[model samples]
Target: MTSAYPNGDSARDSQDVSQPKQSLFPDAIAIPPEVLARHRALVLDPATAARTKRGNRPISTVYRADSMLIPLREVQSLVPRPGQVSRSEINNELAKIGLQLRPRPEQEVIDGAPPELGVSVPLVRLEDAPADRAPDPWTALVALRDAFGDRVKHFGLDHLVLSASVAVEGAPVSHGGMVGGTPVSHGGSVGGGTVALHTGSRNPVALLMPQPPRPAKVPAGRRPVVAVLDTGIGPHPWWSKHRPGDPIIEVSQEFQDLLAAQEGQQQNPTELGPLNHPEDVPNEIQPLLGLIDSHAGHGTFVAGLVHQMCPAAKILSLRVLHTDGFSTEGSLLLALHWLAKRVESGDPDEMVDIVSLSLGFYPETTDPEKVLQVKAAIERLTSLGVLVVAAAGNDATTRPFMPAAFGHGTGSAASGVELLSGVGARNAPGHTTAAFSNWGEWISRWAPGDALVSTVPVWDGAALGGIRYPDGGGLGPWMRSAPDPDDLRSGFAVWAGTSFATPVVSGLLAQALAEDTTAKTDMVGRAKRALIATDAELARRYWQ
Candidate 1:
């Protein structure tokens, strides 16, 4: 296959001299000139530009699978080693090079843990110092890592992770729709306010019904909880039966607080910002208009899939990604740390058995320890018996997507742990690997992900893609019209990605745990013992 990065750099095995065969799928689809211009226009809009700023830095909304984004002048590092190097000593060393650290107290401290999970500090480049042009935050980070070497293993770029969805032409970023290069979805005309999938010539019909009642026989504590760290859940008919005060689908206050801390006082509480894709705006690219964000109902769809396979499981919804399917590595790390804390709390009501992460990003460096902060957060959860399930991404490459790819390595936390499961996507009919699904030895399992039906928000778009006919001499609501592709009043949608597939495995794991007759108190221990068999059973049932 061609190099995953546009610049022809591979994230893994860079030293391999063997020629790589070309795959039929393209890494990126060619964006039409018109669509490209539309994206440029949106970027220049004042309202849109205002939303992209994280403090004084403007976050990049575009998706480049090969590259990772960190705050422009910031670097993340673990707490300094006491004897080897103190924080003050490190700052003093940086000062010699015309740089200093501005520690982030919020990100550095986890409520239950020491004030040392990891710290993202601003890297101020001194004007009078050696270098001519200011080095990008990533460049500065590499210098620091090289200087410290093995003494500091947990420091590097804080990647801006994205949903494992297909990138489309004219759209700001990939959210499981349209096609730029790798054709993940066939016959779908997306990004111009059209439906994401083209099942036929008609619009998708949502299933207008309430979700089936939950099985009441199983006690609340026995129901395994799967935490979905994606877009926040939206209003949907499927969840109507859930009782009041029940957190069947709710936001994670802990994660929200951490994110607020990261963004500082400029954070917008009502809207998830500094990490979202634009949806409300109409540009030349999305002319049909009134389209919801590409990945608006992502969390709802994922929650629906889990409920379908395992109704008894309680889903803990954590809003990490914006409706547009963009998230920061800092936010993801915070979410993971929160999950670890929940598992360690030993409170059955607060524990999560399976964590479904439907998003990931590729790191520029191949060394596993360089991205130690992310790997360590995931390891902490696994050590506490929480099962981590991550999407293998939709880039259709073997390049290691972090957190998911971490499942393949060996280290202090992963040496003998069997808790991490990396999942790839498959089609439901033939049960074969989807063409767009990332695959390799690192991927632990596969499941049906393409064209799968699930619940979505009960919202309608103003896009008038189909023919419309007015009633009563053009003075009333339209009596007849062609199907509106963006109209999701049906409260259901068909989406494809490893993002969807990861949840299938998570739901199945929860199902297995709920069905187990073993002691429920030690949920962590129970999950650890069942994970290996669960992995094998999933392979036998889905991959055989």
Candidate 2:
């Protein structure tokens, strides 16, 4: 069991004296020349360059991080504990070594301190900093590292990044971890009651995923299902028709099959499901949709969005979060693997056109651990022609969030959290990055996260099975009157964070697949580009 961990820190007793300092943190991966070229081009656009006033050279963008890169913030201190001088202080001391915090548009003031001492501020890049220079950022970081010593126990890529381990505080920050507020989607209190600013409750999708107009005939006859894998779903009015026999309804019996194969399979190949189409429709409500985890109503809420956007589309729900709000290990991988099988059936007519995951974590987790799990799942599904959309995370770090960011790997590090494709948030009217959403290396696009709206389940804890009220199980579940569509009401709320961003993208993608199943080629890249292009278009307004 200990060996299951990729870093192998669980069995620290069986020692190898040789490998100590070499790989203390994740090593920086070298970027290929081609990708770097594209990244440079994007950051140095003429209009973008116009934003810079610092280096004399016009530079627009600050940092270009990996899709899964999570930025680590260093602790700021002038007088290093008994042993060292702060890097900011050190920079101020050296007339030649002026500390440049933010550069491009404006240079930060050093406060006339010493060169040996340093202040840990927000990590800066060329676009957002005072000066862009080779080797200096690394140099400033090293000065901090030398002063901090083993207190830098945080783990991540080093040389390229200022190793997350060495900071004074030892906790690894959650890139998309800080999100959620209030409860609109489920049986509260019982299922790990949600709270604002603490990464809790009723989280979901992105907004306005641009799609080409489709013909009206397809949706007129048949509707497809958009699967959302999140914490759990509440028993809202949307799922009033849910039944007992089909407690765990899915598109087919292939759910278990997908889970089993993923446990040990390494390299992902084709994962399409077996044919199980019965020409005659069953009498019961087709178990076209499913809800998992007695406690996690998140799955319920995420799937509900699909229902709202594409009224005709069916839903295949998978519960990955436990009744206690904890999403178990291996569950996410199973969900992705399951989704791949359903999409790669060869017969395009029966495939699930869109798959949605509204979870986020650091990018490294996306590699051999989760990335292979998802990418393999995606390659197979998309090849068979399915679209997968995820949240950009609500951590709102300076860099882009994970899963959705390009080239990120997957693997759970210290916390048992699995990072998935993430969604960035946006504000109303402005649609800029929502204040609550987390950011990472690849900050591609942004949509609404703060004060967004969505649907949740309406059921007593016991009726929903084992779940209870948010205040903890002293009383029986609260039964509010079901939402009546005819009676107008306010469904939108002022919640914020990363989980909020994913559903919008998922809903939009589902709309596209439900409307035009034929446009599945290169859909993943196209969707990514569309998101960025849309944000870029919105950005034009600010510049003008």
Candidate 3:
């Protein structure tokens, strides 16, 4: 029998399900030969070129600027005790090799690193320096590190990686035997205005149903708050109509630069636009519009999953990944620092209870320093009572992925963090883990990731009919038109990935925290309990 779970090819049959699909344009899409040639130069490796034939991959674009992180504390330690080194002294030393340092923006500061360690700065504009005098970016970074030793802390190329989620086109699988009824969409007013869409029999929300009402005695102000860090949450009606004011938090200009660069636009500070709409490029060049990368609307989809389980919990949408679903290690660190700073400085109202990271990188080197830096950041966030959840990755390998793997480590001040692997949906026979989920002892839990339906950015009707695939395949649109008059595919999609599995755990933890007053004192412990309880509940309802 065909598996009930989508993407449920047995692990024995498809060992490489976690690998990204080949480029949408197996044959080159239309573009000027010169532009295509220039794009080819941008590909960093043969593997990247093979996977990104149409040049939509961020790592294969001009934005792949070489950058390295320098720990300032180590640099400061190089000077004699009680002596101070001016910024110029550092710059002058770097100038010999055509490198420079600048202060990190205040908004990116967070408790990830000790204040005594000083801020980690990026080594920028290495290409502009005289080639003969200036060594390659990596060489210069290494020379500086050797000269300074541990005082330099860590030094390496700023690497790029994509989000873990994958968006697929189709209807979601049904789970009626366990949960009952097709999932229905719900609409409610916010800010005193009626929501544009309504929940009805024909328009059931996908993947989640409202929880039965909690006891009246449950404590107020203890709802678990979830923060989603991914591509910017698009302006989806479900979130806009449910939450008053803007649903997304404003990001800093430095963050904006990262997005702009990824989109292949001018990266100057003045040229950068807001993260929500970074540029006004045409569909041909816009990654999302062209379907060059499949990660568009990733954050919105993740938020939708969290909201489905914990409708009343506060959600903070932070955009870190570009539309192409790519971000550098430096960018990810900056985002983590920004969130940690808020939790550290903000009042109780602003503190976050859970952080969902659906994105991660596979380091090129085996050095543990970079991983250690990320671990420190996670430790810092958990230290402040925030639970961190990460996707075990789509690579389907036992090789550990960072942040997710970090969840298995000890010594953190708080201990609510864990890695989630993807499993097939309810009652899917013979398939436990989703074919795409990475696995190892490090994975803390598993959740259904196949054929998950959630929110997406509503597309303008212009593209509703369909767009012809560039290769002349019959009209193959990125999104299909809604069949039911009341149901709109414009604002929803069915996708599969370990990235989605993570929020399932986050939402379950949120629901558990919201109902259990006793768990309030130790939110991290509460999160752990919730994960165990949720696993049991799923097993009872579906696994048996």
Candidate 4:
């Protein structure tokens, strides 16, 4: 077994130190009282609590695994320290169960103060037994707790985190049947009398559209850069034309692996013969435009919004979320670390003016250590003058969402973070908040996210999953289709969620930073001030 202590000290040896006594569950920790009460209740009746929690949620959404972060001291007290417990031993002890343990990296110290817990053990799910054996998750958790008692510091679902956006809505409206030998859709109007071509098709065999002109240029070195941490960017024409050079600076290998795994799972044996090559098919007909999954194009859409709002701002695409739009807390933390590294690199161009995070997680417990880690990461980034923006979530509940809710406190770093809530489009204004958007005082800003039209991976034939179109029937319109004329830019789609709202705020902030010369060095403070001004202005215009 590997030593739990960084100094190579065994768990027992580390416990014999003459230092001051420390409680595994410390008073300074910030686990919400309600969370603790619920945990206690759960431990008392695992089966009932588990069943109740899983009753309404679809099985697809419910995570079958429970991940626990155990402190080293607590582990030392266990009958068999987690590090000392082998896979076979655990499986044998708890029938039809599996456990895998890995040591967590040391927690970051804040303000020159060391963290309460020096080392943590991450207990992850390896696999599950047959359903007839017993209900999973709860059964597995109960068995581990029975064996380890209080040694299990914090237990929660290894939630499958995803973008806070809801499904796409409304059918795209097309203009005259053809314009200059091309099928074009009239997208209302942009500046003055100019009609926006929402959708355009060239040859009947080749559904090509004309690309929009390049955005107006800004003064060199004056453009604010926004880093998008989401799914990977694209091979779309718009992105390809705008970002001629290397656009995506970083792509997470873990996310790529997950994407490949999803693609492998999505492979249809009937559609493609046993030996058919995927590359032979046209790009437009492929699902997700041959990307990993439906949500793989999410980052591109978000970047498009930012570009549309702040044409002068540069974009840095950092792929963190998997193709399915899911990522774990550890993955997020690593991404933040990467961001911090880039900012500290001393290259002015690499320094991100703002970070747009459209993703979040809802942990069953508010484990103080985990919360503090996230807070520390945010503080580290903000302290370096990078503004962070996040979605308020689509849960449609008052339950607080992290990173977003972290933006709300009195802490110095909190001011640098902004939380965006979702609102209906200006044309379809009725409800102050979108029905699916999470709301409360924690949300710092609101932006139009309902029925938002943005870029999507180009595809033809039918949208993935053969989802129904808003026109009351038939297959959904593809953002990109086969025989696509290379003359036009990529496709677009109408989606809704607080996820999109976050990027709106991010783009607005980037625009503010680009236009204000004096605010460049202190963009965080500038962004907060701008947010306050906008809030007041919005209230005066709408609330009045």
Candidate 5:
């Protein structure tokens, strides 16, 4: 899609006056093409069950399993109540296509949704099913929809969701060997003797400056919170330097409980474990190899952006994506549903004023029903007064990316809060779209995303690149040379993508809430007012 604004002074002047200037920073050292290629091949390989689709250009790569997620209520709607008739009928219908219901989790596990909202059953294809049947969950769902037709629609079967794929929205590697209409370059270099890595054609240079967190404007108990749903935040000095009882980042007790309960469930890989320590290395895909996964430190980087924007806001660091940059729609649904309920409880301590989603997917189809469960979960959060800021995606295509696209138009009254913000990536001055950023009407706002420096996990990956004076650290403190492209030991990186931009918008909204001393005291009232007012202020300045 063509950019929304043409280049030149007119474009710069068109930017909202209320928005701050987006400054450019030195880019991070680029990962070697072979390293990026290896990572992408592992994550997006069709043999791995991950799928990629082509549009005007290649979009995002979505990783999926063979299972389908069927909302229990929707399935129940297909059959009479158990008391009225035996419950065997539903199972019988599932058996027609060789699908079988997976075991259910404890009600407390999926708490926040209605008690009757039984665990979403993962219906697996029978190993012995006919060979001619649809091979994947989406195809099977389509077949079922076709067969059931109006019956499915009448029963609100929209929730028969795909256990679809969702990836971190950052530009990590090219999908289908293409990004922004060009093939990824196999080589690149930067000054300082460091080998600069290029993601697709976007250069990410190495930088050493970590954005320091400013003091909170609000007191500990009253600070607004922004929940970052992405690869978990790893160890970083920004949070470690804070005094006890006051932290810039934290995982809530409730979120901890959810993770603990979900652990070992096998239904979904939670990536659940301790965080904020050196031992808690962020590279999950190939730790032994010591190579940084394409998405390692993604959450930490995003959290740091928010920290710089609103230090007074407590960051709820939720780890939903694996270090490899992939997660399932089901896992996201669980987190979102749980969050909606957490907000519904009206506990000020647990209140999340903004949800920064730097991840999303392009659904196989645009039919609203295809995204029903995910959209419902998001709508539930917004209705409760939390503003969701999602990335418009990094593929530079106009294809609608989920959750973010929900922000398009005025939004539904059911959303309860102001509309969700679909954020696109703008270049340094933050005026025009980044070449790698997805655009089109669904994008509601744009922020500086190209080569912005922020905190990353202080990791020395296994990959061997860049030269050093001493072969094995024999020089100890003296040995130094070029930046290792994959090494994040500096705790800072110059990365680009809509992933980072979403947090800029989230942090700004949180800043507005934190600075609003005269706003209503109630959580919902304050957040709603802040969201509407901040959104309008943004619209006045950013939307062209």
Candidate 6:
């Protein structure tokens, strides 16, 4: 609901309220004021201070977000009916709470910054937790999302940034009734020698597993390389495809910033790596233009989907989103420039095969300005021979989203050089269109969404353990119904958004590329054509 650039950022709106409010950071573990006062005292306490001696500090606290909500009625109560606490008085009180609430642990996490200086980025969904902390971590996260409900934003957590915590086991309602897993063919998806993977089942991955890819004739595991420049990825089982030994990867900004720096330093030109780690490659994978104002985990989720689509592919997960979900124009410009520089270098070390983005360039710009950036970036990525895939956005009422709407619209032949693909979401047998799905005529391909489950950090899962009262988005109770109804693994979820849809298409797009060895640069164009040319249904529905 809050999407304006910041003279009054969403952060300001929360601050506009009266005092005694709880945190909006989803993982908030309430600490009584007395407890906080005690903790602060201990930090500066001579005795407590001496215990650490010279060491910086230890992570003694863990966030326990019992609930991610604050009743709207509670907030209404704080609104001092009309004449009370004029702006100046309100300002004084807010200034007071502001100072204290900030340094608070949950507050930092609200910005996607951990309370502790080095708490590796908090993973959002269960499928996206670190290897050691997968399923359980995600459980905690959902519990948190549920706990907060509409109170989530009011508590100061990133709006639209949520963790999905479904379980990934067999769906009793959907496992094709194949007992002991006789290997359902995944609804006609063959996974050998790059066959297309068609997943229309109600499985945890939102994807029915494709038949495993055949071992290369010579068993040559020529893994594909993929770069996901988004918020961040925490180690998760679904992410295990890229693992040489173990694959659930989420790159740290610490190390990535280091990788982003040209090897030689400020004075020297950027150097292509013998990319030591696969995670290090996303920044260098494609020409990243800039960061968009999306939540941190949004990028992380996109990264996870790309990895899911191409398990054999090496992934470079780039963290571009900020806590408030704002990435400056400069950041995106630099991101793109780096990719261009790497691609033009032509060094094998700098070579990248593909890039998929679930984000768009800055909105609010003139059509020409938007198109110029899109055209140029597509041109550059094409020149470098990198296949670029982007989301069409979730604006269901309009034409397909910007870059995808424009880029895919003109087609490869018209663009002449670069090939771009725009994807839309589809509702499968058990699925319904995402209430918020952005679709229409200009739409290209429809993959899937509408309660399609994916990944999120564990802690949030535990917090939002059950379905929150639907805030009016037509949220279904499938998450809580059983026969295990949808049989979603985490036992609770029914997300509605294009964010989910984009990833579904993203994965399939990668599958298309992975299938062809003599892959052409225009593969993206060809794929676009494949969907558009055959979209009689689309034509009848909206293009009439």
Best by TM-score: 1
- Model 5 over residues 1-544: C-alpha lDDT tens digits? 1133422122445565333333231122122333333222111222323222321211223323344455645544434444765334444565676765444344223544642332334456657787674434433444555456544332111121110112232333222233344433322223432432322221234554555656644743478889888777777777787767877787655664554454324332333232222222445555555556667777888888898878777888777765556555656776787677777887766677788898876654444444566777777777677888888776546566676877744222123224487777766565555666665455666677766778777776654434667645575666666545665677776667788878988987887887777745455576656666666655565533
Where model 6 places Cα greater than 4 Å from the true spot, the runs are 1-221, 240-255, 258-296, 323-325, 347-349, 365-371, 410-418, 430-435, 439-442, 460-494, 519-544
Task: Report the lDDT tens digits of candidate 3 across residue range 74-151.
Answer: 434333334555545456667666777544344133334454322334454445686554223444544555466554
How high is the CA lDDT of each candidate model?
0.60, 0.36, 0.51, 0.48, 0.57, 0.36
* TM-score per candidate: 0.74, 0.43, 0.64, 0.57, 0.73, 0.44
lDDT of 2 by residue, 484-511 (tens): 2111122211233445555655555555
Global lDDT of model 1: 0.60
Worst 10 residues of 2 by lDDT: 161-170
lDDT preference between candidates 5 and 6, better one: 5
How far does residue 241 in candidate 3 sit from its true spot (Å)? 4.6
Which of 1 and 2 is ahead in TM-score?
A: 1
Q: Compared with the true structure, what per-residue lDDT tens digits does model 1 show for residues 1-544? A: 1122221222443455344443433323333444323211111112233221122322232222112223222223423444755455455656665765555555444466434355444456666677775434543444555566554445444555677755432233233333554443344444553434322211255565657667864643467889998877777766767666564665556567666676444223322334232111212124355556566677888888999878888888887875556666767877787788877887867878889999987664434445667777887888777889899787667666767877742222244225777777776662456666775445666777777778776777665544677767777775667556667778777777788888888988887787777665665678766666576676567442
lDDT leader: 1
Model 2 clash count equals: 98
TM-score of 2: 0.43
RMSD of each: 9.4, 22.6, 12.1, 16.1, 8.5, 21.2
Candidate 4 residue 453 Cα shift, in angstroms, is 0.9
TM-score-sorted candidate list, best first? 1, 5, 3, 4, 6, 2
Better of 1 and 3 by lDDT: 1
Arranged by lDDT with the best first, the candidates are 1, 5, 3, 4, 2, 6
